[model samples]
Target chain A: MRAKTADKIATSIIIAVAALIVLVLAGLLGYILYRGLGHISFHFLTSAPETIRKGGGIGPQLFNSVFLLVLTMLITVPIGLGAGIYMSEYAPANRITNFIRLIVEVLSSVPSIIVGLFGLLVLVNLFGFGFSLFSGALALTVFNLPLMVRITEQGLKGVPREQKEASLALGLSKWKTITSVMLPISLPVVLTGTILAAGRVFGEAAALLFTAGMSSPRLDFTDWNPFSPFSPLNPFRPAETLAVHIWKINSEGLAPDAAEIAAGASAVLVITVLLFNFGARWLGRYMYRKFTAIK
Target chain B: MNSIIEINDLDLFYGDFHALKHVNMEIPEKAITAFIGPSGCGKSTLLRTFNRMNDMIAGTRIEGSVEIAGTDIYSDEVDVETLRKRVGMVFQQPNPFPKSIYDNIAYGPRLHGITDRKKLDEIVETSLRSAALWNEVKDHLKRSAFSISGGQQQRLCIARALAVEPDILLMDEATSALDPISTLKIEELAQELKDRYTIVMVTHNMHQAARVSQQTVFFLNGEVVEYSETERLFSNPTDQRTEDYISGRFG
Candidate 1:
């Protein structure tokens, strides 16, 4: 065969593979929106679910997902950034550091279902945290922390060596160089990773199932006190996230309109994840510009 | 001329590999001194030793001591940060931070706890003026440092190094990555800066050494072949290696 003809065939095959991925994604999104958009309303978004009734909503579940995400991030970001900086900047190339990196890689690849089982055993039973939002947040941290560390390390590593040298050569302390010079330069990558992790937290079901529980107590939205048992702000209360709610309604929900509720909740979850992905790209670009002082 | 830097039996090693062997020299204050050599001959390594930049590398060791301003820099009592502040350095590549022109110049000052806005602005202006970059970039101080040409960025880097007000300036082939025009500009800037700051530069171009340096040191295979006045080294080299290397017979 002619080289030109073979090159043309290879290019076409690559393009076709890329097109297939886009097509599959578009079809999945279109089907979910088609089935769920008609059922969505202000009442449906804000009201509680009704068992044995045709009308049901996922309002509390949505709020729980958002709240759990915030909680998990509050726990994860500091630890992740610290560990990452240690790995990239401070840690000597040695056996222990290599072992730690290997562990992080192995942990990230572990299945989410396995993480849920581990959470159930340790957080719910052994630690006596019960099935609460805090337990769920902890489980999600286990699932997300490896990714956050890897991303943060990679981001910091991506910064040119010259930048670090320049700052240090200017008599900046090691801490100051890492924080002011290195962190700002690597912020875009770190921010993107954080948002990607948030998207995972939002759509995670198996991990939350055994940790956060499949039921929420009757929540008082107006009760802003975190110490109150009935307050939505309480981390100790049992909660069901949007993804878990969808899974439950599909499996054994007693409501008459369980399928419709599942579909609507699934659509909302998909949209929120999609929004997160787009937000990651936009925020990364915006921050990069801000840091670089480029218009 | 008063000697500001004195190196005594300085031998440097990267692990088992000897990088600088038995180097000894006294560099004069407020004058330009140039180290000229081929790649991997330890000119750059010796330059890095002045600010202790070599400490960043693993398994690098040095014997004897490097004294600057009557103080042994390698002693345990000496602080690397303070030593670096006193001895500023420019690299082979132009390394302006990914920040606004104003911020890039202000970065060094801000690190040493200079916070008053007016004082920072004055420091920025004078530093840029010293680097001969103020006239070109004054109007667009808010623009990114990367927005300018290669030559302009190199000047900005020089300005950044100058902001801390160091007593000695080290340029590790600062203009090697630039065009001839930019190289000429930097050569002129080095000439102007040496009267205020003790400037030590490493250069591949022998003409650059003769043009700007009062004293020139030639290195070969990790050893100083010759150290003398620039005019004498070029016009009447005593060593066969230095004479051959300068006349382009061999490195």
Candidate 2:
């Protein structure tokens, strides 16, 4: 009876902690939505900023953010995935391999600001990309590569040993087995990792400030030519993303309705990140069902 | 009684630990040969060497020759993938790939580059029938392999191993994890399969070896204690260790 009461007490404590966490998260989200949702008009979303006035839209900044995400993912996915596969499947269990794994772990834990500075020095200055979107994409790639590789390796490693052995036993070549059988089974985990990294990339601000630049060059949606300076597709142009825009407006206080713009942008950023997380989970579940045929 | 597999002076080591020492035996073609031994007796290790499945293990080294149809399996000229294709294996657990029933059986055939839809369907039907599971799973070919019961899944695994047209099947305690009825079903299936593919099985159940195997090899301390006809090995007194093992004196 004493033990049972103790168990009940422990269970209650755990439940209380969990409820507290949920409450805190709900409170934060509710407060942000309450403060920022009113400023979100269609015009506020689509129009470019006005220098003299207070309440111009964040159109260019939003476009730049999405464009940067697409560019960064294109560069990061192949390299990160390749490194992960090599480390998990091919690398020998030697001191050198252990050292490499150790380096990856340490790199993943390093501050994003430090990575941003490194990118500013090597990519923005040394490579002479000069505060362009390309430079920013490279910076974000460096910042997120360690996370992607680590996640990918962990996901692959989570696949059951029997699956690999069964594939090989059936005469599938090592590479074929990995690509066809192993990768498919671990697809859910890999997708989750990709999305988690994506969510982080979508909201990242510190790294882009030094590498991607603090202000956009006023994009022209009318001019569809990718090569033009004002076109959204120009990788060489300076791009200010949403998170950075919030930081810039708050710190500079130059725009008349800087406080309102900052609140609205923060709300958008929070909502987008939440969407990314939810979308990732849904996609992961869908892939798992399709691959496993678990109707 | 032509022997299809010949193992000569086989010695296996896992890093510094010696697993099998100076072992040898010939396995007859198209017959069920059973290895009956206690735990850690190197029966499974020897089974793995037949298909070169031990190559995946780190620090696993073998010094000998395992010849199947006059070809040395461990030779540099012999491809491991090719050797494995010819020597299919079913593990202790029923490990069905996370695919539909049809896809699971077609997995091996597709790996070897068979892409025709009609051909894959035929192979899937034939293999499942061979494993004696086609009747149960025929209506739900598109269902996940995991949707079936455990017994059915084991048979699915057997069908999967058979689909690749392998000449030999290595079953490493394939029935141990099953129920009595499932075990009997598999035993009957093995008896039927022995007409085409050479079957080598390792089992802890002495009655299983006596019931199904034409020949039985008893192992103790990484060495073959006796290799003889199943009836004689079970009934007659040749080596005291073999007699004791059969009589349930000590494993």
Candidate 3:
């Protein structure tokens, strides 16, 4: 009778903990949507921000946000994916592999604020990249790599071992098997990991301040060239990303219309993340279907 | 009977543990040979050694020599890829790749650079028909290979092995996972294929071995106990261990 009572209590506790987590997630999402939507308008989305009217659009900041996003994704995706494949496929389970995995895990748990400081000291101040879009992308990549690696490794692990063996047995060299069988079989998992990484890259802001800085007035589009640094013609110049824009408008300049800009920026950030998640999910499913079709 | 494969005092080790003792045997060309053994008798291990599939396992080492058609299979100078291309293997389970039936046959040919669509189509049709699976699956070339029944999948895998046009085909208890009908179909396919390819199979069923194999080799405790005609091995095995196993007294 006493044991039965203990079991009942344990079940109730587990249920309560689960419900509490759901409640918190739903509450946070609900509040953000409600508050952020009120400030959005076509003008808010398209127009440029002003030091005077505050009502002026977050045009430059919005541009910066888009630029920053593309840059960060471009840099992080290849690197994170390569690291994932290396860890999952090439590296055997041993002390060195385990140690590298531990380091990546620790990076994931480190505070975003500390990441910001690391970017400031290691990338910007020490390396002299300055307050540009380049620094912001570098910082975001740091924030994103661990999550990307972990997720990618998980996805690679999900591929069937038989598929790999079949390819190898057919006389395909190591590289061909990796490209033809392992990577393709594990692609859906990799894409899922990529989506999760993109989500992290989009939502992150605490690490960008010291790296990219909080400048919002100008439209520097020059950083797009893979080779060159920040030029006005280059979109790669550390443009103020969307999250940074929200932080800047809400805290600095005392612009009266700052609240509206923050709301609009917040909405855009949420929408960007949602689009990435939904689009990647669709792509992953389509690829899986195409590959799994029987002859 | 030309010796297509020659194992001269071959030895295999997993780390320090010797798994296959100094073993000597020869497999003849264009013949169906069966290796029958108790569990842990090294029949499967000996079969995998021909294609270097055992390279996938860490800490595995081989000594002595395994030669196929005068090529040293385990030599450092030998290209493992080309060696495997000439020696094809099918596993116990019907592990068809998650692909279209056409792609399943085309996979090996494509690797050898036969990418023209019409040529691929011909190979697919010919391979499937040879495996006796084309008539049933003629209308569904683009369907998933996995969607078929287990028996059909096993045949499809055989077709995949044939598509490569390998000189030797190895089956490791290939029918062990199938229903009786599927087993019979595969056994029939094996007999037909033996005319074109040297076939080596490891099977536990004595009846299956007798029905399909021309030559039979009985192994016990990492050594070959006897090698002779399948009928002779079953009816007049000279070795005590081979007799005991054939009589169902022990594996």
Best candidate, lDDT-wise? Answer: 1
DockQ of 2: 0.80
Per-residue lDDT value at B188 in model 1: 98
Residue B72's lDDT in candidate 2: 85
- Stretches off by above 4 angstroms in model 3 are A1-16, A220-236
Per-chain TM-score of candidate 3, chain B: 0.98
Candidate 1 whole-model C-alpha lDDT, 0 to 1:
0.93
Instruction: Name model 2 segments beyond 4 Å from true.
Output: none
Across B85-109, the per-residue lDDT of candidate 1 in tens digits comes to 9999998899999999999999989
Sorted into a CAPRI-style docking class, model 2 comes out as: medium
Off by over 4 Å in 1: none
lDDT of candidate 1 at residue A259, scale 0 to 100:
89
- Best candidate, TM-score: 1
Question: How high is the CA lDDT of each candidate model?
Answer: 0.93, 0.90, 0.83
